[model samples]
Target: MDLGNKLYTLRKQKGISQETAANEIGVSRQTISKWETNSSYPEFDKLVLISKLYDISLDELAGITNINNKEINYIPIKTHYEYISKRKIGNIPLIHINIGRGFYKAKGIIAIGNIAKGLLSIGLLSIGLISLGPIAIGLLSALGGLCIAGVSIGGLSVGIVAIGGFALGIFAIGGFAMGIYSIGGAALASKIAAGGYANAPVAIMQDTENIKTLILNKLPNTPNF
Candidate 1:
């Protein structure tokens, strides 16, 4: 009904201790306790921090008004969206999608969430047969900011066949690449390398000032060229 009671109720509903709330709001635990007990009032800036930490509007945090024109003394309901398909393979669902403010994990044949794991996953951090995320790890292929898989394509990629700004693999292509067979602005390899500045046993690179073309060992003598 009052500011102190509202703070207490909101903190309790948010499932955080007084110490945790105090740390998040940049105050001492004793200060949080005093505020909740109405021994001391919070400053305007502290109130803003409290409202943000508790994920409630300033009006709601202060119990400003309600449709009934009564002092509101109820916790705000947080909405979380989730979907799990009925069709499942083994114990995992065919499709699982979970989206919300807080951290949520989705695991299924096709998973999508903040953090996901599945045969085909898409999320912030994903792991699966084929993953798509900011940071992804996949068995077959991956496409993300940082990717690692059999075949990867991202800003920084590592795999059997990698293509990105900085790539490392058996066959790599990027601005800076290193592999057995590499092609990029700056390429380094053990076998065949081709780029503006290439270095390998068999290198095909542009002739730059003072940098001589190096052809060390002969191309590997393999039946399959």
Candidate 2:
């Protein structure tokens, strides 16, 4: 059976409502409903949490069981070697291990499920030059829940140029910002800052008169509120 069926059966057995499950896992009720209906799958962390909550092994949740069958007597050695060892799709490795290559040409490029580490990687928790995932650690540009990079954007961000709900960088913009040049609701900066409650050498309140010129001069590229 698929994961959805397994989850439904498990929840029904436990006599738990979808809302209870959602609260336990920090997700919306709709997210739980989606997982139960096979509309979507939970993240790796959520799956682990769910498995623990149900007091079952991950293998059981995935519907994997021990079984043996005697069908073929002789298996080719080369076939086993080719399929199980250092397999590649064109230049990119399909199932990469320690060292690999993705769609791009770069050394030490790993693109696996859940975790990936390489020059340009993509996965749930990825680390690379241009990483894209739920939680990314890209040196140049990163985007996720809590990101740190040269240019970062997320709920909580730290970078050279950061933008998020709470941001810290050389140039930042967020609800609660702190940087060299900050612009947000509660901005705190060293040089120039603009926000409702700003603190800096050069401060411009969001409601201050003639603040447009200061904003234009300090943060010319910042998006309009």
Find the candidate with the highest TM-score and give its number: 1
Give lDDT tens digits, candidate 2, residues 159-215.
999999999999999999999999999999988888999998679885677766766
lDDT of 1 by residue, 145-210 (tens): 999999999999999999999999999999999999999999999987889998887778675332
Question: Backbone collision count in every prediction?
Answer: 0, 0
- Judged by whole-model lDDT over C-alpha atoms, candidate 1 comes out at 0.82
Which residue ranges in model 1 land beyond 4 Å of their true spot?
1-75, 207-217, 220-225
TM-score of each: 0.63, 0.48
